[model samples]
Target: MIGFMPMLSKELRELGSSLKILYIPIVFTLLTIMQPVTLKMLPTLLKDASNLPEGTIIQIPDPSVIDVMGSLLPKFGSLGSIIIILIIMGEIAGERASGVMAMVFAKPISYVGYFAAKLIAGSLLVIVSLFAGMIISSYYTEIMFDKVDWLDAMLGTLLYVPYILMTVAITLCCSAFMKSQVGAGGVAFVLYLVLTMVPQYLGSFFRKVSPSHLVDTASNVIMGVADTHIVAPLVGTLVLCSVFIAAGMLLLRRQEV
Candidate 1:
């Protein structure tokens, strides 16, 4: 953990300088807000559709506030994950390519500090962005649709944090191992897909334990239908994140850079 604080401060400073602190939250806010906005406007948009038949009777039902709030996680699960991959793909690989990592290592920083700094910085950016987006979206949904439980909204979003953290961990792990940023991104994206998709088809137990299941669990929490199986996936996702971080540190230690 030598140089952990300095490395973390450096990472945070770099994040601010790169404008990632500004744009990432803006993107998350837009993505989350779009859910309620679209739901609210669906009836009007469908009623005025140009492609519909002249006498078409569209009967779109208005979605409840719970349903609208529940929809936010899926959008984040898909597009938000991709955005994260793109943002972090080059963090290690690009730095290594430019010899920045080597230069940083020339200092007194330990591999744990270096890897943890990247992971924490990335996770902080994403989690803060998500919190901003969810809070604003919940406020907008309350105004546009109906009242929502603040406790449910915040708790649901908190439950989803581990999954997002795992994504950052996996991406950093990929970046640490690969020499090319594109290769790191591609591999991380594939691993993301596998971690999210393959478990459901494996078995019922696998589905319940998968990191992707947390998205559904979070949605259920928002909708007030959550079951007692929450701890399993939560712990499992955290363990998986630790595994990836350790893998990254190991891989990084073996490399020259």
Candidate 2:
């Protein structure tokens, strides 16, 4: 626990030096803001661009706050997932490949502490970025559309965070085994797709088990739907994250570095 702080600080410093600390927020913020603004302006933009007759009208429905907020899940689930996987795929593998791990561990250090630090740091960054985007999105959504219930929106967004953490854990596990960042990224991406997308084609059982359920649960909150049973997916995600963390620690300990 004592060593976790410095290790976490090192991870944070690395993120800052790499400019991810600045740009990740920018990317997420844009993603959040883009949907509402574009939806709000779509009629005008389409009408202006179209070469239709003067009497022609572009009839577009005004999106509700729920629609606007609901759209964000898919945006984050797809692009945000990819970006995070790319950023974190190198967390441990790169260090090991570049001999940084050896140098760092030449002194007395806790392997479990190192692994915990990386997971917590990466997860923290993801949670912060996601919630920040959600907050901005909520504000914009209220202005452009109807007002969303703040408590529900906040609860839904918070519920969605474990899914992101699960992705980070998978990336860390892949990083523990792969020698290169590309390899780790590829493995993590494939696994993530399998976990989040392939389930869609399977039976209802698969839907219940997959991390994809997290999105559904969150959407229920955003849509003001009742009886969104989140316990199964939430528990599944926590278990997967724990398993991945344990696997990463085991793999890292066995590596020659």
Misplaced by over 4 Å in model 2 are none
**Model 2 TM:** 0.94
lDDT (0-100) at residue 224 of candidate 1?
89
What tens-digit string does per-residue lDDT give for candidate 2 at 38-98? 8999999998998989989789888877888887776678788888898799999999888
- Tens-place lDDT per residue, model 1, 145-235, is 8999999999999999999998999999999999999999999999999998999899988888899888988888988884546887898
Q: Can you give the TM-score per candidate against the true fold?
A: 0.96, 0.94
RMSD of 1: 1.3
Q: What is the model-wide C-alpha lDDT for candidate 2?
A: 0.85
User: Each prediction's Cα lDDT score?
Assistant: 0.91, 0.85
Which pairs of residues collide in model 1? Answer: none
